[model samples]
Target: MKVKNIVRTVAAVAAGAMLIPLAACGGGTAADSGKTKITFLSWDNEQTMSPFIEEFEKENPDISIDFSYAPPTAEYIQTLQTRLVGNQAPDVFIITSENKNDLIDNGYVLDMTGKSYTEKLSQANKDFVSRDGKVYGQSISSWAAGIAYNKELLKQVGYDTVPSTWDEFLDLCKKLQDNGVSPYIEAIGDGADRIPDSFTGAILADKGIDVTTLASKDPQTPGANEKEAVKAWMKVYDEGYASRDNVGVSGDDAKTQFVNGQVAMYCTGAWDFSTFEQAGFDWGFAQIPALDKNHEQYAQGSPSPGLAIYSKLDGDKLKAAEKFLDFMVSDWSLEQRSKNGDAITVDGFESDVTEQYKDVYENNLKTGKYFLMTNFYSNPDVLISTNNAEVQQLVQGSITADQWAENIDAKMASAQ
Candidate 1:
């Protein structure tokens, strides 16, 4: 999953303390074990990754994984950066949007350009971790976030599904509120707002605009495209269909509200399906509505972080790392990942994501009808941080949409 979706509460431990005796990979320091010990710094927690590690070790008896954990987004990046600088980088670790540029540009990650393991990856997954046609990481799954609505709640307003267009969506929100239901809740307090990003994708695609141009270090007009999208998205706040109080809500809080049946629709992804199932509520997931009839629907999404090997590795260590990556996309591993609710994007592999996620998985992830600001933008962390602050102000009625867009442009310019 992307940085925006991961929890940031885990403290990142120092890699120095966790490095095995075989930290210097080409050396035979662990010869006593008679197995190639591969050090892996995992972005996913131990609970989720242990099963895969166990299975891989059981199958490949000649290899051993010396595993360590660092939670995603900021902490993991910082920890990995420190380790790389100290010449103590793990043999394998996650390479995500937040650090792919640094890892590839600095020659810290191995290039898998013609690797057979990458042959199964979809184009979108390959592109996510590639630079200049050279692939660096092996990403297997992708995720899409869209409108998740309470089925029974929508029926109360005489609707069975979310509207297909933005205007109609707002009208439905109004009707839901009129019927004494909390219309919508999305966390605008953290990162970029999903709805406006989806709108931006639809608008850019409709106009045949390539997002990479706008995402460059020096765009001709920094926020020109986003202005229209932000304006369109502000209608939800301007019409009072959704509460400005959402500026303080978090993804967890929004999910809690949705589970309690306090809100009719919640903007999220399939990650919460297990919880929703336990909540005992009928729900449906749909692509975020289009900007208008002329535009197609889009969602906010990207490939999950992928496994990248340390570039300096060679000999036995390198072979072991490659074997681990190959095993990750093996049929057995893919099945485990699918069962864990990942929308597996490896070609020829089918994922059994929950029913509520099928529409989003098929129409959004499979079709590449999704966008993420971080995936496209240069200095992505700056853009997301600025966007979170700016959007909260926009919804709180402190800044007009024009001003909000200008502020983001100014921030992007200053950051460059």
Candidate 2:
């Protein structure tokens, strides 16, 4: 679970190569034409963005677009870094917790304070855009991750509702086990799910401590709060609810098992909805189960993926970039997004969520609950992504819980 271990693995892949060529449009460049062209570099591919891009282009006919995409998460960051260094960076790009600090430190991203678009989003969403009161990136949508369960499996075990408390959840798991169900399936091998970390977040929030603060603390310190959170995860391991064999199971495998009805509950996010639906199961979503009677419900997520203008652009191109970004956040843009079956990130935009998940969306909004996977502004390069696999190993019994906590601390220390 060391950061270097994962980083090396990713860096070994062709997709991990530092300087991927931007997808070139066959049309002429900005200098040749009267129109301004702005390149949009994103992790999402052209097909995923076709609807939004089409609408934006239609509304702003004068501005042309050059769209590009890289693979998700780590590879995307490395690709963007290479682009910035070579001065071939896109006019606009995604700024997430993984690369936000490095981009800010290098002065590659534009300061968006006082922009009209920044004011258009909800205040809560706006909080994510600013660092030291200077806005940089605007989150287009919010996200949350939790247990998506197979309803029929639960009913077969004589349960109608997903458990709310950890104890009840454990009881339900036992029941599912008694009835020959795999109770829960977590992605231990993927090294990113961090199921234990999520349960720890809920535990910290329950104790009236900030989950981010807990994460920010030195994991090696072993304070009372840290121990409590660690103990919450250890309970799952000690009770045999989770397995060490999961250390070899990837996220896709877990999803497949859940979809195949091999497991009752799968820990994941709303992003997995399409995968599950395609899996063809009678499934539904729920918040992460509470840790205890006193614990408040909580779920882990990432900041809405944002589109930010790169600092290097100027003149008509700058104006074009602004126009494109504005269109991206506009109501018209949101409507198109809804129609295309994209996930909702903005407050007022309607979602393309399946009818079965309407209640899940409503409940998340009603509770005002969210926890980012990485704190974009606060600890951008702190190696939060590598801890999941280690935690998974601990749950699956490949590694001890103490070793998992220590591994996280080691990564944070190295990053510092």
The digit string of per-residue lDDT tens for model 1 on 192-219 reads 3788778877787888866545544465
Give each model's whole-structure lDDT. 0.81, 0.66
Per-model TM values vs. the true structure: 0.87, 0.80
Predicted model with the maximum lDDT: 1
Q: Write the per-residue lDDT of candidate 2 for residues 1-416, one digit (tens) a residue.
A: 00111342246455445354656442266442766677888877777777777777778778778788886677887777777877788888998666766777778889988787776664435545555566788766656667888999999978876788878888888888888888887776766453444455556556675333333355323223344555675665577766657777888899888888888887777667888777777787887776677766666554465778898789988998888778777887777766665455565666767765565455553234555434522344444454554565566666765676677666665666
Estimate the overall C-alpha local distance difference test score of candidate 1.
Answer: 0.81
User: Which ranges of candidate 2 are over 4 A from the true structure?
Assistant: 1-32, 73-75, 122-129, 192-194, 200-227, 271-281, 312-315, 365-368, 373-386, 396-403
